[model samples]
Target: MNAPEAVNETDAALLAHAQRLTAQAGRPAPKALTRLAGGRNNQVYRLEADDGPLVLKRYFTDARDSRDRLGAEWSFISHAWSRGIRAVPEPLACDRAEQAGLYSFIEGRKLTAAELTPGHVEAAIEFVLAVNARPRPALAPGSEACFSLAEHIATVERRVARLATLDSEVPHVAEARQLVSAQLQPTWAAVKAGILSGASAEGLALDAAISADQNCLSPSDFGFHNALIDDAGKLTFLDFEYAGRDDPAKLVSDFFCQPEVPVPLAVHEHFIERLTQGLGLDAASVARCRLLLDAYQIKWTCIILNDFLPLGAARRAFADTGAWAERCAAQLAKAEAKLELVGADDTP
Candidate 1:
């Protein structure tokens, strides 16, 4: 990450631009700005103003990456706020051309894994229910949203294929190559076969898309990792760059499968029961979710190795996340840990 620098010519120009954008949003101009850390796909800054604080996000864009991140987040937050879902950051303003967005700053500490609790999970579940409540608005599918089981498997395959192409000998490249070729490839094949078998037993087509009602207005990367615990103990969720219409089953799986802020296995059953019941999901959908749990476990394992890919590493570099070798080694360990859990058949 770049160190805080004195206001040089470049800094002055960027700060002025931020202030201009804030003023356009009908918010007070920021008197000062500080670059915030922990962002992995964009540049985030804390903009200080007399009225209060706001967050300025300059999203990462590339010719290879075509997802409209700004549009997805702005639309998702706006719709949720319109529906009286105040558990998320308020969408203040955005400049599509600039790929920048300003949002109400949330004053709270990000939750640690140990800080995760049943209440937090319940609140998250409620947020999901509220977002998907009746009178839903029309929106695009989430970033890489998978409606069918086949799509989910195919997504993992594509990710693994990318990792499979890594031929470098730098840092953890050899370990990642071994994991992908020896472990990930075979594991994915087994997972795909298992998911297909489960789908057949449930009488669901592998490629059949779920009905719209069964779809969710998902905060695609939903979990405590994307949440902050305010002084009032309110869990304010953040980062909806990938949020939009998605499979509720995928949401449920992701909530548990995410490595950071690990939700205990004990809470898994309760979460599944509550979420499935609250969403009014039919038995088949619930069954499908059970089958997809292991599938998503593998998907997340692929996600952990994103740093090994060129575009993925580029995104991390854009966010100023340093220590690439350390991060790659650590991510490989985490991916291996997930593989253990996936093999255990522990989670329902």
Candidate 2:
């Protein structure tokens, strides 16, 4: 694990960055750096140093939206540890200029969907409940008190629209472009109608708003794919770059969305039940989840749809064929089925 990473120009730059971080924190320079895998938004490395193992995450400069994602994550993890919560990686040194931070690596073998058991889901449920028990005001980006489902939907719509702007270099890109275009509107309408129905029945106006009480600070990319299981039989959640006060419903939905972690339907039910029970959710929360199912389903449709976009193809780093294409085809059907799940023209 201490093997030195090859010093490419990028690696050399990271070395300098790491040196600065270590010197600033009064620690020895790292002995080696190992680039980690599977990040689409950030470059991560495991650094071996005299002080022990530290993880460095460098933010992506080309993120679609301009915001201090790095700063927000630092706030989330730092505050969590400040309050004695350590299921997350302990935040260490960071340099805002480099958009990189070091953390104490909670050593563990990252788990895959194949290894997912009810026990793992139970542990994950317990961890999230505790993590969300407190409100992290520092992590909030704006005056908003909670995550906005309407805003999320709007963003997804915009991204789907942007797909048209990307040149269709691959066959999947063209197919996905057509699919998303054909379905996004109807899907969104169904979702909105459901919410309206839920609200109208309760004699309230349809509101796409969720309060912090109904949400929590979430590691937005949370899933078994982003978590690890240590030898001690403990699970650790990873990837907080997208972490912030978010709709709890979104959190659970994202967890189940990852293709790499295939959570069974039974496990999904148990996790949801335990989470709802743990949160002591009221009627509003329950209703919110129901309405949110539409958005989450739509979100996943948008997510897998990305593999068809030019940028998505580039990020996927593979040609749109064979297994990848098959995966896309499956996702396309699944996404379309979402609309059917709610029924056509069916008012929410």
Please report how far candidate 2 places residue 171 from its true position, in Å.
6.3
lDDT of 1: 0.84
Tens digits of lDDT, candidate 2, 62-115 = 454455768877887887778787778888788898778887777787676778
Q: What C-alpha lDDT values do all the predictions have?
A: 0.84, 0.65
- Error at 284, model 2, angstroms: 1.2
Candidate 2: deviation at residue 146, Å? 6.0
> For residues 156-200, could you state the per-residue lDDT of candidate 1 as single tens digits?
788877877763734689888888888888888898898888888
* Best-matching candidate per lDDT: 1
Per TM-score, the best of the predicted structures is 1
